[model samples]
Target: MLEAARTTPTALWNDSSDLSELKQSIAFGGVGATCNPVIAYSTIKKHLDVWRPRIEAIAAANPTWGESQIGWQAVRDMSVEAAALLKPIFDEHNGRNGRLSVQTDPRFHRDAKALADQAVEFHGLADNIVVKIPATKVGIEAIEDATYRGVSINVTVSFSVPQAVQAGEAIERGLVRREAEGHDVSRMGPVVTLMVGRIDDWLKHVVARDKLFVDPSALEWAGVAAIKRAYEVFQARGLRSRVLSAAFRNVLQWSELIGGDLVVSPPFKWQEIINASGYDVVEKINEPVHEHYLEELNRIPDFRKLYEVDGMTIEEFEDFGPTRKTLRQFLEADADLDALVRDILIPAP
Candidate 1:
């Protein structure tokens, strides 16, 4: 893994804001790190000894701020600390790598203006901060809006080829607008995350619900194939936004997407496992998926939505099975974070 980090054009990213984990990933050549609501909540949940006092202090410092505000401030603090670790790499690699992605409030998914407004604030937190905006219908609008305003964005809650393509297009429009207005667009590094593993999970749900005859073992290849398909589309369209492989369920989730100018972000433990495996880091970015797996996966409609570029229309993005599910999950994570902070503010008997 270390050798591949040094040798391959592909970049490794840590899907955590944990300082210790970030340090480990940095040693392994990971240039980027990210935190969404679920990740941020988990970060605090796992480190109560360290974060509990900080949460109490934040609440005390801002008496008027509610639990949500205090909780988000904690997320911001984590992002800033993580971004500090990646600052050197950010300078060395320019803006394409070395970013700390911070997600906006998931409750604002329907409000593009609210999302972009929060994005502006998050971008101000650090030079290397990459704001995450979900790929809802309004989110496409917000992506362009935030890009024009100079916020480097990572499209989240996305799980389809159409979502990736539309996201790239939205980003292109934003960059073009910036170029037209004479704003510097060079330092802005935008990405569209294909939560490949989540898509696989969604397909599994479909299989169980519909009792599909799809080969169960072959289902593992679904995400790899989906990303490959999205990457092919990104290549053909000459998209500036790179497709990122996130939400790791297996080694192939990151390993198969390795190579090219793209990013493969797995959790710290997954990185440990991948490194221990001593997997040869090969350039399989352009490798074709097996025809048999594709045929078997094509049996499921949800898989078709993920595999085909035109599977879901723009109007269908928010309601798409996986998108809806992920958005709800993120929102729940937000609520969970608030509850944690609420406990700190008003401890129960």
Candidate 2:
């Protein structure tokens, strides 16, 4: 089994660019990569010379396939190449952390039925692929239904506790359904990506209340605390999904959660952080396990009730200004962001 500190290192890469550098980074330590249409469009636009032949070839046989078709095909091909690059680690770790995630276009974010259909199609293109879904109302519903059908999901763009909890229950409900049917539940690993930096970037107004100012230390600490509390709830409920810390804007956030199961970071930043340290530290945190949390979850009348609840979401919290403001509120809360910052970031020298 892979150690917790080694967890998984997934990064975002431009789909059409020379994956040579990206591949080299993966060889160094990156476990997987995440790509979207915007990334695909931008990457291909910038490096069409590198990607034209590949895209044209895919579009050749299926003459009917248009821009959308070609875009999604690129998504699959990039993910497959990334998975192949990490195959050694996958085989070595027995499939624990060497996994790549690819997101469906944001255009499908609210269309549950179409999103589920795309999930199935994407899974067929790559066996190691974990289909990424937005945490919208319909998207969460699609995640629950698709997981029940045996599709692994990565719930993306999550920003609040409520959103994270909903994602956990959706995966658990699927696992429970599968277990009851005597199906193999071993390959299932759902992930909820808590975008911390964006929150701090959004909630800047409250950074300084009447007489206090929020520091990067406080922002980093509060984000981890929120994610930790969510994981605690997941353990309590015996949920099978894992937490993936993502949208990390700095090295500090990644350092704080080095013990987390997986963190999909930006490609360039991850490389910088790993090299600056020049060495891996001894693991310090244990995987959280709580039997009572599981028992309480089992007693629930319907885990799906969370679907109806509305709270902060990536939708309502779009852009940096709002995230910065919300983050400041957490720092100002009674939640002890100071203590968390000290423990997670300021390691003993």
Candidate 3:
């Protein structure tokens, strides 16, 4: 399944200042491009002197577009250009591979309908575009609704098994719904992104940074264990959601999760994975998304609804409070929460 994935690197790391270097990376093996508008906004803003003419041309041609429209237009244009550069691979793979990903603004991460709308709009901009979304409650809902319409989704920001499970189930549900409604399920192309390194970085506060290097085997093993569990959930559910590990900070985590059905790696990590040795297949455990999931799914509180403050918009994300809270409660009743959260939250990125 990993082999079938469109192994694209995040374009955020690409040298926008040097188109040649960016093009070279794309040409080498990147089948897709990933970007968040905020990141794009920042990057393009930094290079606006070099970008103004292009934006001006687009705005000049369109005329009615506003400043925000122009900015997003530039983003779409770059994404489309990057997608076009990868068009051959997209065409060669016959649409199963070589797609580009653009995330909806983080501001609306919890708004299902808004995300669904973005999926439709973004899909119109590029044929190979995969609308990136978080693996949150509403995000999953958005994924389902979008999938029903045949939009590709890359579920991102996942930090735990439950989140990963939600992504897989959402994919299967979307597939089932589409099939029921007489839409083609095969074309929807769903991918689940499991973040690895962010959890490690968070854990650095708890564990000595030097310990990560001192007992490299221990740190590495914990990450692999988390990924192995995630894969186990993927296989158990028998859902078609392609697992795409993200937030990769180094080559080792890439090695651990390379068995994922798909992987959206950062550029630095992409280079590491591309250059790493011993990419091998591993065993998958039998686990299914069960009725028990409905409990958590129902308990999946609306983070956005809870925190409506303009600045604290995304605080309502399940990962921010409910998910972590549940995990905390469980760990308190069980064993070491610190150890488990470190493994689960910071799997290996």
Best by lDDT: 1
Deviation of model 1 at 244, angstroms: 0.3
Residues 185-270, model 3: lDDT tens digits: 55555677655555444343334532322333333333334445667667766877666655556655554444345454555336
Worst 10 residues of 1 by lDDT: 252-261
Model 2 sits at a Cα RMSD from the real structure of: 12.7
Model 3 misplaced stretches (Cα beyond 4 Å): 1-22, 58-66, 206-223, 268-349
Better of 1 and 3 by lDDT: 1
lDDT of 1 by residue, 131-239 (tens): 9999889999999999999999999999998898999999999999999998988888899999989988999999999998988877898988988888888888898
Candidate 2 lDDT by residue in tens digits, 29-79: 665555544444555555656666776676676777555555556556766
Decreasing lDDT order of the candidates: 1, 2, 3
- TM-score of every candidate: 0.98, 0.72, 0.68
Clashing pairs in 1: none
Error of 2 at 10 (Å): 12
The alpha-carbon lDDT assigned to residue 69 of candidate 2 equals 58
